[model samples]
Target: MHTEPTAQATATTHPAPTDPACDALDGGPATELCAPRRGRPRSEAAEQAIFAAVEELMEAGRSLSDLSVERIAAAAGVGKATIYRRWPNKEALLVDVVARLEAPAPVRTSTDGSVRDELIAMVEYMRQRGLAKRSRWMLKSALSQMNSWPELREAYQEQVVRPRRAMARAIVRRGVEEGVLRSDLDIELLCEIVIGPILLRTVLWDEAPLEDPGLPEQMVDAVLNGVAAPPPDGRSR
Candidate 1:
């Protein structure tokens, strides 16, 4: 669902990359991420330590489940107060990480003039990203946590999902405006119907293909053909 936003260049503002301190946070040394506010600036050292500890621990499939605050503090080489000050708990930390994750690019449109081609490309994009091995697990985990943590879930939707949805809506509007797609179609429900197959495979049925180049085309033909308005024949079935 995460195609890049078209408005990112014009709608978003980027701060100047001048300050060495801020640059660290932007992907520089990173120590500047935790520069203390008033009192000698809290050590940026602990933030890096915590990140390394989290990454390494997660790589092994080990997590904060059995690990306590004291243990994570020790592993991160920061005081309990330090970790708590930034993140109330491990879930809070994970929420931030998930929000920062980058999604894959959308599927390409092989033939641009046809609405059918656009539909196929959209489905193809979803298939490509939805079939990811570990990302599926990560998605499921995040969805499960949402019910328990509303604010974190809302932030994830805002950062990750909303932009993707907006892109899809824009594409649908373009399709209709270009005269290739029917104007009567309901964009909102259409989005659900369009994406339902791949999502069902990825999240529910758990049967995404490892490689299926024609899969998107097939999905588009099936959904599009069935939903298109009645034929000109005027011979109602």
Candidate 2:
């Protein structure tokens, strides 16, 4: 997603010089002619190596402040240019690294699935994410560091938090439209009702269990059906 500003600006401002060969081939002036690319394509292997290197460094107890692009390049076995080509700065790189480690779960888009089913899927994804060792470590580290690092915090919010929140809100809105969720409730509140418990267990309480496959279903059904018992006369409290 990162681009070299100078190179990009130069390419935009100055088109390639007209080529005589291209003009002959086209039988017209080659004002739109393009030069052949000289740079190699991005290597997936190198990118993976860089991600792995960051994880390895973190696993070795290196703090965020300690991880420089130079160290990452040395560990990844790529030149500094390779890292710069992919990310504008260390904060961007680290944001990507966290995203890779977390691996955002896909939201179900199929129309055949019920609103309840989609809610369960979303909650289950969080449960599975919480169970991941690397993801848990990265989440804890990122949350603790965000307060001190505004750039990293903003990047994480824009790249990670905003997207996830948008997806959750979309799902809740759909449920309201389908009459599965309360129409009067705010979309944000409905989302919190469905997923908040799972998040509490997953992020706030490390000791809380996420191993139960039935947990997501239980949470979703509880929100849908209510936890309160009927009064003796079956009247509203």
Candidate 3:
């Protein structure tokens, strides 16, 4: 008669404990402490795959105009949504690819070097980049077509060219202030005088050699010391 109550009766008598922190606002059953994230986490492997796919396509003679998110995704073995999540469109993706190929410009600190040394470093960086681009057919082809693509061209100017020009200007300005360079010349003109030859060789003259490691130092020194020959009297020209 006094036997233990049925298991179902005992279970009904005692309820499971609940955590107040996990309870919903409406006082419903306890939920997870935090809401689940909305989307999948980014994967580095996937990103690298996408970049490789783009490069491979370009290397295979596929023009940027012919590339699409769908094609890239298939080549990369990822969903189109993955590429879209990272880049809004094909142009944006291509910009990143170009940037990866070119790499970042060198940065020099005041404590590490002088303005002349910085200028030499900048020119050397361009020389190396030119050599690298020449070695890669894909990069060469992509860069050759950049001018015709307005979006890509503008982005390149904003992201790469502008920053480099600004750096050159800063260095030139510092040189002028320190009396290392002539203050009579315009800053822009001075910048062109310093880096113009290297830029021309790198971007325009395909036959120009960039293999000479001493070329940067020679260029900087020549510009600083002037190319004009000395008069017989050893007086200023």
Backbone clashes in each candidate structure, one number apiece?
2, 0, 0
Ten-residue region with minimum lDDT total, candidate 1: 15-24
Q: Rank the candidates by TM-score, best first.
A: 3, 2, 1
TM for every model, in the order presented, reads 0.55, 0.76, 0.77
Model 1 per-residue lDDT tens digits across residues 89-179: 6655655455333235353333355667666666776676556534546445545657676766665554445545655565666667887
Which TM-score value belongs to model 1? 0.55
> Which candidate, 1 or 2, has the higher TM-score?
2
Better of 1 and 3 by lDDT: 3
- Model number with the top lDDT: 3
Q: What is the lDDT of candidate 1?
A: 0.55
Q: Give RMSD (Å) of candidate 1 vs. truth.
A: 11.7
User: What lDDT does candidate 1 reach at residue 51?
Assistant: 62
lDDT order of candidates, best first? 3, 2, 1
**TM-score pick, better of 1 and 3:** 3
Number of the top-ranking candidate, with TM-score as the measure: 3
